[model samples]
Target: MKYTEEHEWIREEDGLYVVGITEHASEQLGDVVFVELPEEGSEVVKDEDICVIESVKAASDILAPLDGEIVEVNSAIVDDPGKINEDPLGDAWFFKLKVTDLSPMDDYMDEAAYKKFIG
Candidate 1:
């Protein structure tokens, strides 16, 4: 898993990536109430806003940390947005992307670095 400065996280498997907000973000958001994910097959670039996560506190944009095409969205979260607070990095993943290139991943932080960054 890798993390973006904006508090999003990405984990890759078999060339596809699962993307979501980090736990720190969920805690900050204070109970997600809604999620607006990008349509599948839509192309996105790094740092672009691809989704919206609204909580009681504020509505936050979930940015793409790498260039890719969205291939799947987590419908489960759309139906029950609180899943993000329960498991932000796991079952609550917002979408999957078919990465256009792997090089940009190097710019993201690993777990330890991310922890420090949030601190």
Candidate 2:
């Protein structure tokens, strides 16, 4: 998995990339209460606000980790926000992206670097 300083994670699988918030991000947000996901087929640019996550403390934007067309969204999170805090790296995933440009990943951090960045 690769991550952004903003707490987005990206993993490529069969050409498309799966994106979500890291466990560290969910922890910071406390208990998640709402999730706003982008529509399928919507185009997103790197660093753009693709979704919004509302927690007990604050509402944070979920940034796109790469330029791509949204292929799918995890509606389960929208329906049950607690999944985000309970299984951030598993059932809490946000979206799947059909990537357009792959270069931005070169600037992303690996797990070790992301852990340091979050620290």
Candidate 3:
């Protein structure tokens, strides 16, 4: 898993990556009420805004952490935004990206670094 300073996380699986917010982000957002997901097969660039999450506290954008085609979206989250708070690292994953360049991941924080950064 890799983490972004923006509080996003990406986990690799079978050459694709599942993307979601970290638990700290979920908690900071208060209660999530809505989620807007990008289209499957849409091309996205690193750091581009791709999804929107609205919470009781404020609305936030979920940025594309890498350049890639969005291969899949977790509709379950759109239907139930609270899932992001309940399982941010698991079933609440927002999208799957087949990244064009993985080098950006090398610049992202590892678990230990991310913990220290959040601390």
- Candidate 3 per-residue lDDT over residues 1-119, each given as its tens digit: 99999999999999899999999999999999999999999999998999999999898998999999999999999999999999999999999999998999989999999999999
Indicate the TM-score of model 1. Answer: 0.96
lDDT winner: 3
**Which parts of model 2 have CA positions greater than 4 angstroms off?**
none
- The regions of model 3 sitting more than 4 angstroms off are none
Candidate 1: where are CA atoms >4 Å away?
none
In Å, residue 26's CA in model 3 sits off its true spot by: 0.2
lDDT of 2 by residue, 14-84 (tens): 88899988888888899999999999999999888889999999999988888889999999999999999
lDDT of 2: 0.91
lDDT of 1 by residue, 16-95 (tens): 99898899999989989999999999999988988998999888888888888999999999999999999998999999
How much is 14 displaced in model 3, in angstroms? 0.9
Give the best candidate by TM-score: 3
